[model samples]
Target: MKVSPDGQPTADVIARVKDIPLYREAVARGHFPVLEKAEIARGFPDNWMTPALAAALDAGEAEFVLSTGTNHARMQLIRPPYFLLKSYYRLWSTHPDIKETWEAGCRRVSLTTVLATEHVARVNAKKRGEEPRPDPRPADRRLDARTFYLNTRLDPALWERADVERMLAEMAEARQAHPQGWYHLDCSGYHLAHLLQKINKWGLWDAFSPPASIIHAYEFTPVNVRRYLQQHFACPIIDLFGSTELGYLFYSDRRGRYHPYLEDMSVELAPVTEGSGLFHLIVTSVRNPHMPLVRYRSGDCARTLDGTPDPAKIKQFSGREKELLESPSGPVAQGDLDALVGSVSPHVFVHQLRVLSPAEAVLAYTTFDGRPLAPRQVAALGHGVRELTGRRCVLDHRDHIAIGKSGKYAWLARDGK
Candidate 1:
């Protein structure tokens, strides 16, 4: 529970670190420094594999897994199987806005990337190791007793009418599976927005049931997209902030107010650059018993309400540290551009900032209604972009902005890098 002046853990963190073999040399060297992914990858399992940890692995109490590599490279991790799910369930059951539905024992329908579904399938197949089971059904991709996967493809934008209908039918089946006839919906915000668009276009609303609560935990949700989801579902729509390694670290309520969900963890914010509002997320957590992390840089960037490193005042999970762009003005993050676009118009769906040169960039976007922005709104957004990046901004309207191969969207793009 004790934390340092900067929100990093104090005695509690040291106690956890003192017992981990991986931290012995770092601890002996003097001060416990920030731990990077490179340092973690350097030694692999041997670094943290104590006798107890190895025994746990053998006993299937813990498992070795790789991160999704969405934000950065795939990170090797060790923790109990379903560690992330347990964390997510805890948050869902305790979050004020969603507790009642959770208490009602609602089923879970997950609509995220097909990669996630495939990863689970691969893991399960490898674990089974040739044990025969019933043939897998194309429509039935259940992750657990309560959670069902609905996305069978990578690109939501490319989902044909048949695909949309199948997902809706699966959702209806998921709802009926629970005795209470209720289910909590979990999804990537972008995926949900795309699904909504498809549903509206195809008039498939009747086939889909309104979830008791909705949590978008997979990736960053644009302000406009969040607004778009709000306009359709009357249920509580929340955004969860975390990673595959950390689980649900924080979550936003129905009102879009953030609350920390750090049970056995602490956080610190170190500025990306001196005098810059942007800060790198540094966390000290003992949540994962086999792989406790101290002063770990999560590769995420954020901004506090007053531009200070008060963890409670964390205003935005702006973007990844690696993706932050150096602008003539200073530094520009995905969130900064999002704020400008959202302010200009809520119709903007997805946007990508392409830096052409040091002094020029193009903002390509798609609208919810598939129409270009008004001339005045376009001019306003262009002006804001120019001021933020200190570049001549060009607004380009597009019918679609492609998702990455990983089934996520990159907000910033620069040639060759």
Candidate 2:
């Protein structure tokens, strides 16, 4: 394994860790020395536990357990030391630009439905008189709602019609009370658009104050969607990249380009198959001492604008690795689909493309809570998919699409085994 000048393992760290007999023995016995080290490093109570991670942490029988999987398969991963989370916070909070954003009291809303937000929502719901609602959705799990936003298990129906109107009214009232109040809107790209649509339906856009900025994390944001949101709002729309295990890794600047936030993490771009500009991302993060993920396969796809992984010169974050479609004409990446669909309906989430044949495909997706795509938008999505794949694709709306056991949205499912 190649260690950086600072003695931290590069992506090659995985191999080095594997080669360590003591470490291997500990892991083989389902003992997480890394977790213990992390706990000690973070100075937490010896028994301190993050409720969201309790299930995985207590599973002493598994060498590694997945913290999140979403659309991709769940990863039973080595846990990094708990101190790694602190390292991430220090890196992000101390960054001059990012710190300015955070210290300015800019709302730091997380737009993802992963464990972090789920935990918060669960913690928050306990403060209410009601029991946390039962979740039938694939992503629903009992969360500590006191610390999170809305619970992931809460039905989309709860945010519908009257409920949405009330929320918008409250937002408007907040704006009125504090003119300089900076609102931070965060979530999946699809959910933010849905919120905007609800505001629009109520003719509340003009009445509500535009947030100081908007951050879209967890999934790829299509180019057209980026343009549309930026054009409509007078604030900056930022896209961030990271995972549950890694936290935030990259953020877009004012120029609408991604810049690396992790000085300890290095990235490499490899071709999806062979001799293709389409590349897969491989990462080596050194901050997580408890569970260092070296050259961890993130299952995301991208193509460097300049064909290299120079953090300072990154030009774009294309899309997910598995979401690409290979057609006779060329490959259609998820960003392309995002662009087409966003043009049709910005509120669509959990998009999946299934190939029935070389010339036929099916598109399935769900709308963001409190919003629905118009019939015209659905037709446009079908037409766009057909045009991109050179195949007639059918667009279908489902009441819900199952989230993977890993709690991620799978955007593409190939037909047959």
Candidate 2 regions with alpha-carbon error over 4 angstroms:
1-66, 76-98, 110-117, 123-148, 151-158, 169-179, 308-313, 329-331, 339-352, 362-410, 413-417
Q: Which candidate number would show the highest TM-score if scored against the true structure?
A: 1
- Model 2 TM-score on a 0 to 1 scale: 0.66
Query: Each candidate: RMSD to true structure?
Result: 2.1, 8.4
Q: At residue 339, give the lDDT of candidate 1.
A: 86
- Model 1 C-alpha RMSD vs. true structure (Å) is 2.1
Off by over 4 Å in 1: 6-9, 127-140
Summarize candidate 2's per-residue lDDT along 1-417 as a digit string, tens digits.
233543234434544355433345533553322222233224232222333235445664213435555645444444543333444345445544455544555434343454544544444455565455444121233222111133243333225666555445544443444436765555566455555666676676665566665667766665544665766677666677777666667787656777777655766655666655566666666555445555556666666667554445556666766667897656777766765776777566557787888889999876644355677776788888888889898877776666554334556677892
Per-residue lDDT of 39 in model 2:
31
Write candidate 1's Cα lDDT for 1-417 as tens digits: 457775545766777677567788767775677889999998798888788898999999999999999878998999999999999889999999999988998888899988887766665666678432343354336678778777877788999999899888888887887787788999999999999999999998889788889999998899999999999989999999998887778889898988888888888889888888899988888888878888889999888899998778988889888888887667888888898889999999989999899889999999999999999999999999999988889899998888898999999988666
